[model samples]
Target: MNLDELDAALRREFTGAEAERRVVVRQAGDLADTEKAETDRGVPLTVDEIVDNLSDAPDEGVASRWNWWMGALEAAYGGYEPFQVRRIPKE
Candidate 1:
């Protein structure tokens, strides 16, 4: 799914597996090359540092948004632009 779709799912879906995995933003290029540095201060967006951090824990009114990145044994981010994602067996 596209990042936007993943984002919507992250916000609305509850798989009851918060402890399994988490997600972080990743650069398809060097982190220093983009404006994503701003998310370091805690914001959320894509391709721009202005809003690049994951959403702060989703509140009770926001569904599972917070659970998307709060607890996990592992976290992953896209390694390419228009960041496409598919799941495959982990080696």
Candidate 2:
């Protein structure tokens, strides 16, 4: 999904400052890139897939949900740890 779609999907699940939401979208784009490279099946993770993955996340915030998703990816595939959203700047 494009940034706009990603942003909208994120909006449905997460409530946060606009600034924070922007950062999450940017980071999600980076994760998309990483998924493109990591996947051997040639199908990158779609926006729907991402939202579904985050749906079961144990945390409430956007950043936490993102980190949780990336954490799962990291466990299944090494090298995804770097893509985890470590810090979301305060708005």
Candidate 3:
């Protein structure tokens, strides 16, 4: 999905924090761009896949869930650390 669609999807799943939501969407876009550049190396990222991956995370917030997933990817792939949601804007 495009960035707009990804933003809406994130809003649906993670409500209340606008800044954090935007951060997640931005990070997702970055991931998509990175994946697109290396299409042959990894699975293409989609809104559904992102949501599904974070759905079972042990965290309660969107940023937390996203970070959890990013951490997993970093542990397995080694480059996803930069995409991790480092700070959540106070809301």
* Winning model by TM-score: 3
RMSD of each: 12.5, 2.2, 2.3
- Models ranked on TM-score: 3, 2, 1
What residue runs in model 3 are displaced by over 4 Å at the alpha carbon? Answer: 36-41
Tens digits of per-residue lDDT for model 2, 11-81:
88776666767877887778677664347336567777778878889868777787887777677666677
Best candidate, lDDT-wise? 3
CA lDDT of every candidate: 0.31, 0.74, 0.79
> What are the per-residue Cα lDDT tens digits for candidate 1 across 11-67?
344332322212322222233344243244343333232122234444432223322
Candidate 3 has its poorest 10 consecutive residues by lDDT at 35-44
Task: lDDT for model 3, please.
Answer: 0.79
Question: What is residue 81's positional error in candidate 2, in angstroms?
Answer: 1.4
lDDT tens readout by residue for model 3, 5-74: 8778878876438888889889988878767424633666888888888887985788888988888877
| C-alpha positional error of residue 62 in candidate 3 after TM-score superposition, expressed in Å | 0.4
TM-score of the candidate numbered 2? 0.81
In angstroms, how far off is 41's CA in candidate 1?
Answer: 34
